[model samples]
Target: MTKDEFLQFLRDPDVCKEIFEIVKKGGKPAVVAPQVQPQQKFSSIADKLKTVYPNANAPQIQPQPAPQIQPTPQPAQPPKNNAPKGSGSLADKLKFLRGHLDKVREEEQIAAAKAQEKSPAEKYTVISNRRCPICEKDTRVVKTKSRINVEKRDLDYCIHYKDFDPYLYTVLTCEHCGFAAEEKKFSGAWPNKLKETLREFLKQNDMKFPFVEERNAEDALSLFELAILFSEMTDQSKGRQAILNLNAAWVCRCEGFADRERDFMEQAAVDFEVALENERWPINGISDDMATYLCAAIYFLINEYDKSTTWLGRIMNNANLRATAPKLFEQARDMWQDIKRANKA
Candidate 1:
């Protein structure tokens, strides 16, 4: 039976008692088996008794007493003039104000805690043998200390300090060789002066220094180093800028617009090829190898098929790089295959 019908049957005490008796005797109710026709509705006490005692032949049904129903009294209406106006009662207003005050106090505590946790200025030691700018002695090497202005809104002065203000500057002197150099304190922006210094260093060295190459190559390498240092120093903004600079260099390499683009390409190919000699296509992180793939793609686009195939093979063989950039690697593979097929044809 449906739940509603069963519930209605339960509401009737006579029907419930009859069903219980049938269950006690291990007999199915008459309503459940329609093959045995019922003379009257099971809800009726006489019908229920006959159904319960089917073999009794002279069963008498006693009517069950109905439950007494108490009459409900209506409440008296409240007077409209007795109600107070203005939003709500004073108790509710005070409770709301208390909650708001608590929230404010909690926020203030958090702000205060964060303020208290402010990091002291990072100290960087100048390790190179460059002459001391101040003492002129070769043994004045010391640790330079400078605080990062975390609240600086401008991007220019946020990463590294461009201006050489001595107050913001932290000087370190070396004890051994007495080599000293001024490192501009970093906030969030790349120091303008340091970038200028790097640019000048590139120019003075004719871009042929140990780590320097073409413009993009030098920029990429320098930025990558800076990013690594900043990341280690807990300077996230500077680290992010370095990554952006690296990505820009990659784009410039792909577009062939960067100064010394061809030189950078040749150098990069050589680096990757050398890395492949060790059976490690990446030799770095996955993202770094992905940049290598872009370099390979540029070579492929320029009809340097041999170099393209070499780099593409490296990507295909490297399990980590392959997993990270599967789709890009697959495209490179298909392109390489097509080029080979064309050559054979």
Candidate 2:
């Protein structure tokens, strides 16, 4: 509608009255609808209401363009794991690496501790090649003490030591044929009958070699028993058997087996008597003086004081023995005194 016509319509009393009623009924919507009348006009009704209610206190209502409803943004999807086939998450991978590193460190520590704990005997040994008499196979043996500290002697003259005792490892056993013998008798020639018997015995029995590595008192006794067995098979001198039995008794003594020790000592005394009557002097490893001294010692041990005194008297009378073996003579004299004192008591 033209502005002049709209102004002329406002001058009409009836039109003005009707427009006032619509403005009063329409409230804020009617009052503010033609807010853009300064820039662009609304509908005729809006113009009529604006003209009727041209007061500043009238509330201005905006359309707000239907609140421009923005579509609610969906949460972003997590990226797919495109890692390698065997690869895991960062946390899992770290856990695995930590465990592996801990295991490696533990192994290294154990190895270092084991190396540190190794004894001088285990670390450094005097390795010697000695051929076995029966098998002839060259076997490695720890001969002398790599670390030696010879202390006191036992009652039976067995030398005690602070380091590795060479006596404990005196027997050499062949790995092939399992022929075990004393170091002194290791090279001794065996008869054909003995060899055949040994072969048959080995075929029948599966013997465990306890003397291959570190030997205890029991292992030493076992070696002595093996030596005695080998000696018997080869028809060795009674002197060798007596000495072996004596050594076995000493080993039993060390292991605190009193009954076994006594049994072996008694067997040694019997063998020594057989050696004195039947076998020749200086038979096997025992010399004539050693045999005599051993006889005296054995008699004293067995409570045969008269026999001991007789052997001791023989040692005292032999000037050559006294001069040649001063230590043996001295030991025999001391033992003789012990025998006399025991007799008197």
Candidate 3:
């Protein structure tokens, strides 16, 4: 019995009365031990021993060993996908390649307007020497450090760069090898298999673009296209590939190539949709809320109103989304409202 059950039994009136009667009679409580019976086979063996030897012990039988199981041999394993063995640094080669190219750097002649004494103006652009992760070649890529904002719009979050269109120079292209990638992709090491595959790919494809510090929209798009090729060869995540395509589309947008821009945007939307379901959270600073908003916006642009509303509804109805991601929540709400108005019209 449990402790509680035992306590309950002790508190029973009949039980207490029985104990009291026993005490009054000067009789001690008797303790009974549970009886255990021997197995039938053992009892029969004992009887056989008594009959055979009259007052002897039972015979002992030797235990048989258990059967051994031999494991089946597995088939030979495939070769591992690993990094290629190399002699010198890929960055060193890229640096040497950059050395031979003409140092033609482009900067907008228009300078930022003088700020008031109290307000400090930041540099608009920064020149960076980045080495390609795939080619290990160094290239100069100009990055926008800060924006001299002329105007900002709610639609597509468009910002007009007054002096320079900095988006044009976001991709880095190695002149020696036809290898190009975004600034973010230049830092990490590649998978061993991917490294070997890219090495082979570079052998056949020669460098197409010259090393230049400044890149136009066409040049930027070319480099982005090259990066997309590399992304396909490697096991790049869908989210990463989607961003590359989106950036390529952004280049097209800056150049006012409406048809190309729409095509790329459509592909980016599809990739982002796939990434939403299969890829991990918080890809390229894109959280679930941010991604949802982008998807909703993209769908709205493509005239997929149902899909747009589906994603927008999720953002609008989430209880804590407004507090957690106020900006994205507001954008989603506005887009949802736009969709409703369009339908009514």
For 148-175, candidate 2 gives per-residue lDDT tens digits of 6768885457766665556667676776
Q: After aligning candidate 3 to the native by TM-score, how far in Å is the CA of 13 from where it should be?
A: 99
Q: If the candidates were sorted by their TM-score against the true structure, best first, what order would they fall in?
A: 3, 2, 1
| Candidate 3 lDDT score relative to the true structure | 0.68
Clashes of each: 22, 0, 5
- Cα RMSD for candidates in order: 22.1, 22.6, 31.8
Candidate 1 lDDT trough over 10 residues, lowest sum: 151-160
**Residues 38-102, model 1: lDDT tens digits:** 54556654565456555434243566899898988969977655233465657766777788789
TM-score of 3: 0.60
lDDT of 1 at 120: 29
TM of each candidate vs. truth = 0.26, 0.60, 0.60
User: Which of 1 and 2 is the better model by lDDT?
Assistant: 2
Give me the overall lDDT of model 2: 0.72
Using lDDT as the measure, the top candidate is: 2
